[model samples]
Target: MIQMKCRVLLFVKKNMPCVKMMKLSPSPDLNPLDYAIWSILMEKACQKPHPNVESLKRALKKAWKGITLVDLVKIVDNFPKRFQACIDANGGHFE
Candidate 1:
């Protein structure tokens, strides 16, 4: 595991110099958008069979248009509570 981590860090430092300078101590949580908006979008987009790439893209676009600022703000507002839950759980995964 230590060797694997070292290899990963080495690879990051060599190939992903932009992210190499980022702190390695604490990991980040999942994006709130993934938890909130993405699920709704996926549900709407996949509600019916697309049958073609264009249809799928159209469905996704429709879903994207459905997202409102209020939805985003609600997700963003919940971030602190979600993060606190993670901290309370000693960095374990939280809903």
Candidate 2:
């Protein structure tokens, strides 16, 4: 079952680039969740240790709430530019 799913995923991954609408690479540079959101969330949530799993969840939730609409909009606004940079680099590393 897993193998079938993997094969289907691989087929999609191979064809997605030909579509030229989205980049399917798992590079951190290509993913805002990695390049931006996680770091922001981590920094905000990990200022101190949590006493337990519930505490950690609460801290993460509060940190997420603290992220402002303007900040999110700015991050989203930069997304296209980042995609262009990735394309300009031919999927290689870029600043």
Candidate 3:
């Protein structure tokens, strides 16, 4: 009986979710250009077009390492145009 009780307690403890570590301070300083680029990516993400989300996630992840500020701005600025063209070609807005 004691062994079964101990096993149950151990199982419960093991199944409990771990607590997340909270940040104690603001993130290290980001360059203005970096901030701008990240802001653009975030704004686009919040629109949450499901079909594009995966592609956008991949692009943004890649952008994090390889892209410069200018590239990011260009991508962000062109997003609306690309989206609009798709809509036009499809004959209507995305439902």
Candidate 4:
């Protein structure tokens, strides 16, 4: 009876989710929006004549409600060359 109880306890512990206990350490000294804005600015900076950072920021703020992940992906897809260049230069895979 004791062996059976131990086995059941072990199985329950093994199947339990530890998501709440997972550490969600934010990057030191940087806010979450900083990363997103920086990425957008970097991509904009690579274009000819460069883009207005304030205008991009304004657009982002205004479009925040309507934009979704699929919209962002479509924007990237529309700029295949630039997107590919960004991925290659940054050593990151987007797809």
Candidate 5:
């Protein structure tokens, strides 16, 4: 993720010593977790009512648990193609 904002960038620099800072365009569309996992989780969670914090946590946990390795492999396997598309687009929407 591109950490452009000052406060967040400072926080990362202060706390995450091992992390390297790099410049890259924001490409949320090409993020596998955003495109795959979150949409699935949102669909599943929104299908039911989460009336409280516990319920919301429960729903999110269930949704997270439901992501199979097979599904993850499928998503990750598309990364190279997606990254290439992102590069080809010069950081435009690559989804």
Candidate 6:
């Protein structure tokens, strides 16, 4: 696993020299997708069971369309407060 990670890092460094990489931790407070988007998508898309993969895909697409620009803006605009909360917890989990 470590070797694969090193290989991926090397590949990224070689292919994307301008990109800066940092170690990432799993913290929903720092990731808008985890904190908000996924739940919204799941709630909207998974309200009923789908008979097959295509049905699920269609449902997800519909749910995605239901998300408005204003909703997205609000989610992004709330990032500073999330960041501050994460910081207040000293990089630990926050509620």
Best model per TM-score: 6
lDDT of 1 by residue, 47-80 (tens): 9898999999999988888876556556645656
Worst 10 residues of 6 by lDDT: 1-10
Superposition error at 7 for model 3 (Å): 49
lDDT of 3 by residue, 1-95 (tens): 34543554454356533523233213212222333556755655545544666877776665454444445445445544654655576744332
Superior candidate under TM-score, 4 versus 5: 5
* Candidate 1's TM-score: 0.63
Provide the clashing-pair count of each candidate structure: 0, 0, 0, 0, 0, 0
Candidate 3 minimal-lDDT segment of 10 residues: 24-33
lDDT agreement with native, every candidate: 0.67, 0.73, 0.47, 0.43, 0.67, 0.74
Q: What is the lDDT of residue 54 in candidate 5?
A: 94
The TM-scores, one per candidate, come to 0.63, 0.63, 0.27, 0.23, 0.62, 0.67
Cα displacement (Å) at residue 64, model 3: 5.9
Pairs that collide in candidate 3 are none
| Candidate 4 C-alpha lDDT tens digits along 1-95 | 34543554454356544322233225311222333434564454433442687865665554453444553444323443543545676844333
Instruction: Give candidate 5's root-mean-square deviation (CA, Å).
Output: 8.9
Q: Using TM-score as the measure, name the better of candidate 2 and candidate 6.
A: 6
Winner of 4 and 6 under TM-score:
6
Q: What does each candidate score in C-alpha RMSD?
A: 11.6, 8.9, 21.3, 16.3, 8.9, 9.1
Instruction: Rate residue 49 of model 1 by lDDT.
Output: 91
Estimate, for each residue in 1-95, the C-alpha lDDT of model 6 and write its tens digit: 34544555576667666646655437767776788878888999999999999999999988877876656657756766887888898998888
Candidate 5, 1-95: lDDT as tens digits: 12223445465567666645665425576655676778888887768787888998888888777766556656655656887887899977755
